[model samples]
Target: MEPPAPGAGPDRPGPHDGDPGAGRIWLARAALLGGVLVPLVAAGLRGVLWVLLGVAGLALTGAGLWWTLAHTGAVRACGAALAVAAPLTVLGLYATHGMLGPAVASLALVLLAVAAAGRVLSPRSRAGGAAPAPATAPRHPWILMNPHSGGGKVGRFHLVERARAAGARVTVLTGRQDVTALARRAVAEGADLLAVAGGDGTQALVAEVAHENDLPFVVIPAGTRNHFALDLGLDREDPAAALEALTDGVERRVDLGFAGDRVFVNNASFGTYAAVVGNPGYRGAQLRTALHDLPELLTGERTPRLRMRSGHRRAQGLQAVLVSNNPYRYAVGPGRGHRGSLDSGLLGVLCVHVDNTVQAARTAGGRKGGLTRLTGTEVTVDADAATVPVGIDGEHVMLPVPVVCRIVPGALRVRVPRGRGAPRGSRPSADWHRVLHLARRSGPVWHHRPHTTGG
Candidate 1:
């Protein structure tokens, strides 16, 4: 309804203009320091018992995670129970000892700290290689809108009417024909731009076609999760806003990750998530299916395992492997956990392998633990089994073993509106050093301004 502003929403302001947001940066620093001290102060008050209880809970949680990801049957159930009970047990201990206030306060401070970290760490702008201004608008643009994707975001946003109103032809997908074929038909019919108002699965298909035809591809973000759109800094909440790119836009060359020859806008998932998502019930009964399947699939009789080879380094007995188009920075909630650049020109690989609780504990603090992350031009995933279940862009599929993944740098021409907001996860990974330095430079309390989350 309103004018287009990518990544902007009711809570997130649109087009920052000239604001550097210095005041909020200092507040974020204060929150982070307070987040740490509150817990320490609480522990100091509770003394040895508090320290022991926290360690015990973390250990229990670690053990539960180990078993949940690698055990089955009764053992698996107990592991799940331990995992669930660990945090609750700590809370209970706090409540029984009259330390409930401290516990809740510490937790709230920690949550605030994380949110502040996200706000501070997230990049205010794309680092470099800003998209070039487009020379001309498309003479004919065709968008395929999935009527059901993202729980009917296309219809809910009235994307059809909006896109058509923008002078672009719209086709609502009704499972009537192959989506890739339909796009090809549109391109062959002299459509100069290719766009999709659907999920990442559909985005991949249309994106590949656009790449092959040397046409600019626009993502409408009318899909569930829309990881690609989020990583690209598009407006997820307003799918219609992306249509602004059709008229006023810039062209940026972005890379696409490929498993074998299949293209993916996001990452190719294997092991735990892949196995669970491959189940048919995932669509109709997601939570139930995940709860039922995760434990068994993780450590069942014939648990699926993978071996990841990123360049020469190899990690074996991996419970899961995520091969992404580009590396993802520190992620928990908000601001981080997505790729910073689509044109990083490397495959981001994450390998997980924790056989027991000890390994899990070590992993919680040490780098040599079971988890491994690295980037390479090419990475290969192999399993002893002839085939592996893979979740490519969240679309379940069974692929032959030794699924090789690689990044084709700047392989696609992506069009986004010029005045887009900061893409999600663009400034992932907080630098504590930066925070400290910023605090010293922020001047005194008198000079400090009210905190603001700039658009």
Candidate 2:
């Protein structure tokens, strides 16, 4: 069978490309020599050289990790390595010298070097401030901005001027208005592209309308930690550049998650966590409550009795349940916080069996309760009670006890800014660059066209 895309397959060969069998043989031999024979030989020689070697090893590991975030691939590969090596180096030095003086000095120097290099190479902080957004195509695009998104990024970022200047017609929506109605109206009026600037919940609503109308959608990230947009590589700070791509960028058909009658771009969850977020002040007090009242939440009588059945598997009396459309559950590395990829179709189900106080604390990134990973097209969460508070795409929803969710493949079309041109012989990917170029040439929409037909 043909291998999947680079990110699609977990075991695909990456930058460490070589014959796997041969590489393993060499690696095993190297480990044997360095770990067993060399160490034994050095001990027999009764030399003080291990201290210097250990220090050098720690310094090198610290340097690699300190730079990994800048190099995404390296971050994936060696993020855990550096985290482990730094501690081991420190421990070894302490064993030898009984003081962290030399080890601390070396680690600091290496970290400083890494920090300096990061600052020097960071493009976002360059001296020229920020350049004018490059131009794009002349397509007639309509925009819907939520002023409440990401602490009001739309109003703060000058996104409208940039987008209008890049050949898009802009509209801002304030207050509790219906975005779906606005989006559907735009589609009916023959708007070629419709982009929404807001959180994932708002994105899901726009996507539902776009999907129903079979219209192309553009994502202008204006949410706190816009995970989907970031994964798609759209510039969060530059709406003009993203808008230019919509006028001239490449379009990709992405999936959307369907939960009963609702749709979402991310995941959904139930239980105490959902109840917490549904509360008026969940976002502001999540960390605080998670720390203080967790004991009561875990051991209290208020625990909702939930019964979950996904595919053929079943669980009972669950305290908290999280059903994700595309698993964003991932950790930076081993023993790290949970993290996940957004593109994978499988939902990550994390159930917390919080029957006792200790178990509840462990559920909050603690050491007691563990997570479960499953693959299913449809998930059902049922409870004995009548109404249950559901958190869908970071927004609360009031629904009946049982809730069902499934993945809708290729349900939405989104225009994203393509990277630089492809190499010779490779087919062109997203045409973002070309789109931007064309939009720039078309110039801004100086006047609104006269309304005709149904518009």
> Which tens-of-lDDT digit does each residue in 1-455 have in candidate 1?
76745544553444443224434555666766665566567666445567567767877788787777566678778888988998899889888877777656765655555455445445433233453656478999999999899999988999999998999999888765798899999999999999999999999989999988989999999988888898888889998889889988878888989998888888999888888888889999998788778656655645567887765688788888998877666644465567756776877777887666788866653234777777788888999899898888998888998999988989998888877734454353543433455556533221222121100
Q: What is the C-alpha lDDT profile of model 2 across 1-455, one tens digit per residue?
A: 96543432343333234423223323333332344234334354432354456545544554444333223354535754765776686576566754344434544433333233222222222222222233344367888887778997887888877777776777788778888888888878878777888788888888888888777788888877665676566666665456556645666666787767888786677777777676676678876554344334444655466787776678788767777655442322342222223334556566656453233224332233433445566778888787677788888887786788777766777667666211111111112222223223322121212111110
Candidate 2 has an lDDT of: 0.57
The whole-model C-alpha lDDT of candidate 1 against the native structure comes to 0.75
Predictions in order: lDDT: 0.75, 0.57
Best by TM-score: 1
Candidate 1 — which residues are off by over 4 angstroms?
1-52, 65-77, 95-132, 301-304, 334-336, 357-368, 425-455
Cα error, residue 376 of model 1, in Å, equals 1.9
Pairs with steric clashes in candidate 1:
7-235, 123-427, 233-423
RMSD in order of candidates:
9.1, 15.9
